[model samples]
Target chain A: MDNNSKLTNLHMDAIREVGNIGTGNAATALSRLLGRTVDMDVPVAEFVPIYDVAAHYGSPETYVCAVLVRTEEEFSCSLIFMIEEEKAAILADLIIPMDISGMDEETRLQIRDSALSEQGNIILGAFLNALSQITGWVLPTTTPAVARDMLGSIMDLVASMFGVIGESAMLVKTSLHIKGLDDELGGTVIMIPDPGSLEALLSKLGVL
Target chain B: MTQPIHVGMADLVVSKHPATLVTLGLGSCIGLVIYDQASKTAGMVHIMLPDSREAKNLPKPGKFADTAVPLLLEELAKLGVNKSQLRAKMAGGAQMFSMPGKADSAIFGVGSRNVEATTKLLAASGIRLVASDTGGSKGRSVEFSTETMKFIVKTLGTGTKEL
Candidate 1:
C-alpha cells in the first residue's frame, strides 16, 4: 500500500481504539463521583471527512461544552459536547447537588462553575491520555468552556480559536450513553494537522 | 371584569375571571395553554423538550411536555372547569437548528418532532386544537387572551398577529 493510504488506516484504527479507552476512563471517573456502578457505552465510532462529519450532526441550536487540548508537538484535539439546556441543568444538578437551604447566590454560581469544569476536565483528560497512549504523543489540555444556551455561539468560538484549516481534515465521533442518566452524550473530537506536524507524527508512528 | 394574566416559562398562574395567559420564545419546543371560558380559568406550559424520560426520577415533573400538559389539565379540573369546554390554542415549534444537508426534509427535525408529539398527546387526551400557529423556521412569542379566547403569535421582526 502507498504511504498515504497506510497512514489513513493507521490513524483510523488509532482513533477507534482510543475512543473506547477514553470512554471507559470517563465511566470510571463518573462512577467514582456518583458512588455507583456507572455504565458507559460507546455506540458509534467513525472517521469521516471533516466536512461530512460536521454536516452529519446538523447545526441545531444547542448548548455546548468545548475544550481544546494541545500535545507536546503542538497537535491539538478539540472536544465538543452538544446538549440541550434542560439536560444541561439536570446534568449540573447531578454533578453537584445543591442543598438549596442556606445557599447564597455566589455559592450557587461557584457550584455551577466547578461542576461544569470538573465534568469537562475528567472527560477531556481521559480522552487526551488515551490518544497519547495510542500514538505515543503527550498533549497538554486547557480548561473547557461550558456554554449554557447556544450551539452556534460555541462553534463560532471554535472557528476563531483554530482559525481556518486548508482542506478536509480528520474527524472522530463517538456516541456515548451514561447508564444512570439514561441519556446519550455525543462527543466529537477533531484533529487538524499542520503539514509538518502531520508528516512528523506519521513518520514517528512508522506509517510514513 | 378582570385583568389579563401573563405567565412565563416555569410559571403557573390562574384566574377565575376574564384574563389572558401568555408566554414567549418557543424554539424547538412546545407551549401549551389550557383555558376554560366559563370559569375564566387558564394555564400555560412552555416545555423546552419533548419528554422527561431521560430524567425520569428527577423532581419537578412539570417541565416536560408529556408531564406538564396533564398536570395543567388536572389543575384546570380542580378549578371547576370541564375538560370538554376547555379550549386550547397553541403556537411555537420553530426549527431554530438545522442539520446541514437535511434542511428540506425535517425527518430528524427536533422542532417538528416536538410539534408532532404535542399534537398526538393532546389528541389522546381528547383536547381539541381549536387554533394553532406552529412548525415554522422563525421563533414565536405567543399570548393567550382568556377574555376573548384569542391566541396571538408574535415574531421578533414582525408585529403581533392573532391566530
Candidate 2:
C-alpha cells in the first residue's frame, strides 16, 4: 500500500476504536434501560460515497424508524439510531409496563413515541459521554428527533445535510443486540462527523 | 425490452421509450423529471440542494436544482428534444423530521426551498409542470416510465399514486 493508503487505514482504525468505545457505552445504557443484557458488535469505520448510504443498510425502500441527534458547538457530528419500525414497536413494548396492544391507538402512539425518544436520548448520551471523556471536548447534543420512513428517504435527508461539504462521508457504525432476543430486536447506530469536523476529531485524538 | 434506470442521490439520467427512470427514497430532495411525449424521451435528476453556487466547480451538475434542471435539458436536447416541447413532473422534497417549535426555521425548510427553486427554474425555462406530489412529512420513491408517460410515487403506509 502507498503512504496515503496506509494513512487511511490508520485513520480508519482510530475511528473504529472510537466507535467501539462509544457503542460499548451505549449498549450498557440500553441494557440498564431495558433490564436486559445488551451485546454490541465490533464497530466499523470507513468512508462511503454519500449516495450509497441507504443501500448500505438494506434495500432503500425498507421501512425503518430513525432517531437523529446532533452535537452543536465545538466538535460537531450527527448520530442516527435506526431500527425496523416493527422492531421499534417491540422495543417500546419491552420498556412500557403496560401492554401497548391493549391501549387505544392515540395513547399507544404516545407511549411508543416517548419510549423510543427516551431510549434514543439515553443511548446517544452514553455514546457522546464516552467520546467526551476520550477527547475532552464538550459535546452538547440537540434534542433527538425521530422519523419513521423508508431507509432511502431518511438517508436522503442525512446525505443532503452532510453532503454539502464533500462527496464522501465517514461513517462509524455498530450493531446493538439485546441478549436472549432474536436478531430482529437489534438496531444500528451510525455516527457521522459533520463536514470538516472529522479532521478536528482526529487531531484531538492525535491520529491526524 | 422495458428497462429500469436507477438514479442515485445527486445524479441524473435520461432515457428513451421502453425505459423507466426511478429514484428511491427522496426526503428533502426533489426528483425533477422532464419529458417529451412525442419523442418518448425523459430525464430525471435527484436534486439534493437548491443551488450549486456554494459547491466547488466540479462536473457533477445533477447535485443541485439550479445546475440539474439546465443540465437535464441539455442532455435531452442531445436526444433531439426541444425545450418548448417538454413537460415536467416531480415528486419528493418532504421534510422528514420536525422538532417541536422548530418547524418554522430555515433548517426545516430545505424541502420547501428545493421545491421553490425547481419550480422557479422550470417556469423560467418555460417548461410547464403538469403533475407533482411535493410536500408532506413523508419520504417518497418515484418511477417515471417513458413508455406510459406516467409518474408513479410510493410512500410508506400510503398507497401508490400516479401524478
Candidate 3:
C-alpha cells in the first residue's frame, strides 16, 4: 500500500505483535477441536511485491487447499488458511471421529469438505475475535469459502486485489504446527489488509 | 537456448520467436495472448480487473482488460508486428471462491466479467480470437510459444490442454 513509507519500525513491530496474539488464540481454538497440542511459529510480517507473493509462500504451482474469509465493511481485509491437499485429508480425519472407511466415496468426500470448512470457520473466527478484542474494531468476516487449487492462482488473485492500488502487499503470516505428529497437518494463516485498511489500522494503533 | 518470460498478475511482456510467455495461477483474471505468426512476435498480459474507469487509482494498463488490450497491441507494434496479422488466444478468468448469495460483492462473478471485457476489446481491435478457455471455478496456468503458436493450459486435478 502507498502508506508503506509512512510506516516505521515501531508500526511493523506492533503489527507483528498483533499477529502473534491473534494466531496464539487461534492455536488454542484449533487444539481444542483436534484434541492435540497446537504450536504457533513466530509470525512474519513483511512487505512483498505482488508478483512474488506466491513464490514467497512456496512453489507457485503446488496444489493447496485454501479457505478464504473476507472482512465486511470497515477493515476490508482477507484471511487465507492454506494447507497441502494431501494434509487436508488428515485434518478431516482428526476433526471427525466417525469411521468413514465403510462409507461410499461421495459421502466420504462430502463429510471431508464439511469438516474442513468447519475447521476454517473455527480457526478464522478465533483469530478475528482476538483481533477485535485487541483493536476494538468491529471486524466481522464473511462466510468462509474453500477451494483446492494451485497456490500461484490463489495468491495472484489475492495479489491482484492489492495491485489495484499498490505494487506490494503487507502480509502477516503465522504457521500452525500440531504437536506429536510425524507428518504435520498444520496450515498457514495469511492476513492481508486492503489498501486503505492498513492506514486505518495503523491509525487505530496511533502509529499513523 | 530459449527462456520463457514469466508474466505476473497485472503485468505484461512481449517477446519474439522461440521465447515462451507464461502466466501462472489465474483466478478471476484473464491471460490474453496476441501474436503475429509471420514475424513470430508475441505479447502476453495478465489482466486482473475488467475495467480501468472504475478503478480508484491510475492502475497499470496491464491490470485491466480495457487498457491491457490496447497496450498489448502497441507493444507488438513496437516489435514491427502488424495488427492485421495478429491473432488472439486466452485462458483463465475463473471464479476461485464462490460466495453464496453475495452477488453484490466486488469480486463476485469477476471471472466472467473479465472474459466479456477482453472479448469485446479484442473484437473491437479487429484481432481474431482463435480460441479461449474461460468461466469456470478452477484456476489455470497458461504458456504461449511464439515459435509453435501453441498455448498450453494446465490445471490441478485436471490434465493440461493445448488451445
The residue-by-residue lDDT of candidate 3 on B73-106, one tens digit each, is 9999999998789999999888888878764366
Residue B40, model 3: Cα distance from true site in angstroms:
3.0
- Across A8-44, the per-residue lDDT of candidate 1 in tens digits comes to 6666565455566766666676557656565544523
Rank all candidate structures by their DockQ, best first, as comma-separated numbers: 2, 3, 1
Estimate the TM-score for candidate 2.
0.93
lDDT of 2 by residue, B48-145 (tens): 88877776554578888998998999999999987789999999989988877667545567888899999999999999999999989999989998
Candidate 1 RMSD computed on C-alpha atoms after optimal superposition onto the true structure: 16.7
Best by TM-score: 2
| Model 3 chain A weakest lDDT span, ten residues long | A156-165
- How would you encode candidate 3's per-residue C-alpha lDDT over A122-154 as one tens digit per residue? 888888889898889888888889888888878
- For the candidates in turn, chain A alone yields TM-scores of 0.69, 0.93, 0.94
Residue pairs with backbone atoms closer than 3 Å in model 3 (clashes)? A153-B25
Q: Please identify model 2 stretches exceeding 4 Å from their true place.
A: A1-7, A182-184, B101-108
In order of appearance, the predictions have TM-scores of 0.45, 0.93, 0.92
Superposition error at B25 for model 2 (Å): 1.1
DockQ of each: 0.02, 0.69, 0.57
Candidate 2 global CA lDDT score? 0.86
Per-residue lDDT, model 1, residue A84, is: 48
Cα-lDDT of candidate 3: 0.85
Q: At residue B18, what lDDT does model 3 achieve?
A: 76
